[model samples]
Target: MKPITALFAATLLASATAAVADDNLEKLGQFKTTGASPEIPTIPQTGPKADAIKKTLAKIKLPSGFKISLYALVPDARHMAVGPQGVVTFVGTRKNKVYAVTDRAKSGVADDVKPFASTIDLSIPNGPCFSKDGFLYIVEQNRVLVYPAAEFFYESPDVVAVPIVPKGELIPKDEESYNHTARVCRVGPDDKLYITLGQPFNVPAPEKLELYKKWGIGGIIRMDRDGKNREVFVNGIRNSVGMDFNPKDKSLWFTDNQVDGMGDKIPPGELNRATEAGQNFGFPWYGGGKVRTNEYKSETPPANVVFPQVEMDAHAADLGMVFYTGKKFPKKYQGAIFSAQHGSWNRTDPVGARVMVTYLKEDGTADKTETFAEGWLTSDGEYLGRPVDVAMLRDGSLLVSDDFAGALYRISYEGH
Candidate 1:
């Protein structure tokens, strides 16, 4: 072959190698496959009907000096994360989409609700959390993705999703189930990303215990923002859909939904606290708190199993929770935990469907649990709305996301 022909062949080989490298990088960077951008879904622009919403609001009971108002309409709003600037609030869902509730005028209420990152293929994208530096992290059923400057780029249709944890990495693909699939995420005080992966069974089979423990199922897992240094933070939780780090002690606190087969009054739901790593909260063995599960009643339980800080009503379906550090509410509300009980489906009489406040002592332990807001569940056993997650705006007011009503609400305090 001629020298020119040989040189051309070498150049072609170099180009091919570079192309392969670029493809690899794209695959590793995004959660989805390359060249597979899906059409963005159309989000509903309208909110709930005024008369119906007002009627439901009238039924709600709150402590004196507090008021609740509809903030925005977000479909399937499961968990929420407020942006650093308090401009955009990202809402996630068990469905395949996320939303952005924008407060453009710096008002407490949102001006617009729009679909966010609709191009990405999200599986049970229910947890949205933001870092102090403006990076948004989302926890899907089997992976976690990060969006840098998400608040600014959220409006752009071309915003990219960087996969911190690749697909099928959080759990085995075959083990995934619709039940307990929605994972909640939070950026802890130490700047690590923490996520809860609920075990997919009502009670995990005995044979699967080793695999579940190895994968950190039924527990909380933490990792660096880049998805490195992953480890289980806590174990033995049944299905915790909400978690937040205490602003005072930086200890991790969460809400765990108890087993269902037991009577409605037994195996109460839990508001748990983890002060140290590797703590086990007692699941399968003890359904919630100290209630021994029938499946594990005969087996020897693990020693040093941690109990809940507060035992909520059984079948309350406790989901999202946050530690109140804002000043908008009364001074007494500071350091309190505001949680959303999404309500139960299996009980003879449904409970929850309301917001709960767990007042905490100075030492960061729960003092007492009380209903902060109720009336979503009517006396006749109808649900007008089911609160899923609780979030706080910069002005110190609270935002509650209700998936049943497909709406978000704001709670503020005005002394009489």
Candidate 2:
């Protein structure tokens, strides 16, 4: 929230100039000093994998006038960022790759899917978002990288990438773990980078609570575009993988996955709203909603702990979300919130793996929650696909990324 530091401003200027001066730098994929580039492979778009995803689409149910189809085949697709020019959609994965899905023909389906900046080694790059002016920021497990004009330079193997938060600086290296390390980010209306940092524990140790609180683990942090004036915007989140700013109010809204190990139906998932900075969404103290976790049941919670605007079904593992700002959707869905439920991992009976819609009241609070699209869970308790993120294309169509099936599904309104 403070002014951008002078050092960061200088670095930003230097990076900006270097990113645009493409001719001066001799590069090979990730190696700017060498001429040898790594072999970049493209994801197969037509094959058994695509066929399987298309077959599963038959079971998906949507409201009248809505239809769903296969968009792209991206392995381990966890999150998405639609290019400002609408030429490509950069999909991030939990593994080591970020894919670029292009609809060059202007067709509904993607014409090509390949690794974006394949030379760069990315670790747990689960979040990729673009600023309005076309800067692409990819949030990895322990670092953050920005690609100036990424949509334009992504076709080349050696796209210009500058690190905003270098390795081990996003979080303590000792605290890094595979669990809860998939981060999601959004460039807020204030032009700041907002990122979620999930604590790497089912329930954080009491001694680590203050440490986590201080570094924004299990919470969201915001900084200037150049990675300056970084501060904890909100704390006390269990692990939120999805968030978006409300177009009408510019307030931040996100989904939080609640604690596990409680009974299947006890602690509910969360869809929270933060109207201002420095707010706390109860985590260790209260798992979700008013349900208190055993770890902090004896201790008192912080004052003014903001509760969720909507308490979702427990263990749904709600992930990426987006506000319906497109004109293609019906009037009732104009300002609604659409989010993905990654489904329950260890529940008695599998639940979720569907898309949900939350309609907001006039005052910007949640009015009701409803199932927007479903059928990923079969009658035999099998998951056809687990939806992880939801993004909007320029045409007002919705793109849902399923990590389970390694595909992206497109939802559009065609009318009855």
In angstroms, give how far residue 331 of model 2 lies from its true place.
Answer: 0.8
The runs of at least 3 residues in candidate 1 whose Cα sits more than 4 Å from the true structure, single-residue gaps closed, are: 1-50
Residue 400 CA displacement from its true place in model 1, Å: 0.4
> lDDT of candidate 1?
0.86
RMSD (CA, Å), candidate 1 to true, equals: 8.5
Clash list (residue pairs), candidate 2: none
Clashes of each: 0, 0
Per-candidate TM-score against the hidden true structure: 0.90, 0.92
| Residue-wise C-alpha lDDT for candidate 2, range 27-112, written one tens digit per residue | 43244632325456788899887888889998899999999999999899889999999999999999989999999987899988
Per-model C-alpha lDDT, please?
0.86, 0.91
**Per-residue C-alpha lDDT of model 1 across residues 283-375, encoded as one tens digit per residue:** 889988899999999998889999999999999899999888898788878889999999989888899999999998777788999999999
- The TM-score obtained by model 2 is 0.92
